[model samples]
Target: MTETTAPAVGHQHDGPHGYASDKGAYLKRMRRIEGQVRGIARMIDEDVYCIDILTQVSAVTKALQAVSIGLVEDHLGHCVVDAARASEAEGAAKVKEAADAIGRLVRS
Candidate 1:
């Protein structure tokens, strides 16, 4: 099945089978970011202006962060919630794991 038909990784919401509704948007964002990354690479290869390259780098970084936030939100809304509904231990594990991942992201 395609992205649309696939069940949301962590949810059973009314939003197009979980993240399915968001999938299109996510892919579009990713593609835009991907192109930005390629442009940065090209700029570096061509020795483009330093400030211009830096600006592109910053944009790429922000785009990536946005994607990360979206995934984290989805995971919490769907996966963590499901685990919490399952059992306290599972919920605890999920929360701890998410926290650790967030910590890592923040440090990076």
Candidate 2:
């Protein structure tokens, strides 16, 4: 059997799936990272030093990792915990999903 997932719609301003309270903070950090990306592109265009560009790239990677960690923590603390309270099977499924997500992040 094949299972399909539908893309989430109209959630930009509704906050993250897990972290509803810190939506503004997350958005601000993401915007800052977006600017950093633009700056890195400009640096490349202007023939900036390779090391400098690599350093910026590393910073962006770290920032994204931080965001990922935060989201995962929120998911486990809220979603997974809630599911655990509701049912053992559901809780196990949520835990497995969280583990898979963490594995992907680690591989990346």
Candidate 3:
């Protein structure tokens, strides 16, 4: 993969409503994750060894965690920052929402 960094909040990388610049990329990643999940289901249907199935499950979990981290980073760099620029109250709300999301992710 090419090495590139995310653009700052006010930069061109900001998409509509402060979403990530590469929304399509996120969708692609999710689709791949969905495929992995389907593969795991197939393994179970085929009566694969328990350990092998668990390994695939672990891979899927890690992929999902990576996606979650990327989304949270995008939210903080884009959405939360935009809200802060708009108004302090809006920013506070965004921060709380983000914290709640992180909390849920952690509990998961």
Candidate 4:
């Protein structure tokens, strides 16, 4: 299945994103998760136990969720805050965008 991502916020700040400082760490975690996913595929090809594959799937899911949460936090701490400081309307729009993202996470 294909994955869909949220669109970028309309705020036009030229500075680095909130996650910039932690970009390396994020990349590392994602790479590890990518390895886990590959392992899962290998397991399936080898006909591993269903529960074992499911366990890996769960781990991958949690890893992705952790990343998602971190990104959301960064966005709030930086993007939303900056927008809020810029103007009330910009802040409200950011807040709504964040709420929509959170809602998608919760539903998923």
For model 4, the run of ten residues with the poorest summed lDDT:
1-10
**TM-score: which candidate is best?**
4
lDDT of each: 0.79, 0.82, 0.82, 0.89
At residue 60, what lDDT does model 3 achieve?
Answer: 92
lDDT of 3: 0.82
Per-residue alpha-carbon lDDT of model 2 for 21-69, expressed as tens digits? 7888999999999999999999999999999999999999999999999
Poorly placed runs, candidate 3 (over 4 Å): 1-19
* lDDT value, residue 95 of candidate 1: 87
Candidate 3: worst-modelled 10 consecutive residues by lDDT: 6-15
Clashes of 2: 0
Model 1 C-alpha lDDT per residue in residues 17-84, reported as the tens digit of each score: 33555898999999999899999999999999999999999989988998888888887887778778
How far residue 56's Cα lies from its native spot in candidate 2, in Å, is: 0.4
Count of backbone clashes for each model? 0, 0, 0, 0
Instruction: Give model 4's TM-score versus the native structure.
Output: 0.87
User: lDDT of candidate 2 vs native?
Assistant: 0.82
Q: Measured by TM-score, how close is model 3 to the native structure?
A: 0.81
Largest lDDT belongs to which candidate? Answer: 4
Instruction: Evaluate residue 9 in candidate 1 and report its C-alpha lDDT on the 0 to 100 scale.
Output: 55
lDDT against true structure, model 1: 0.79
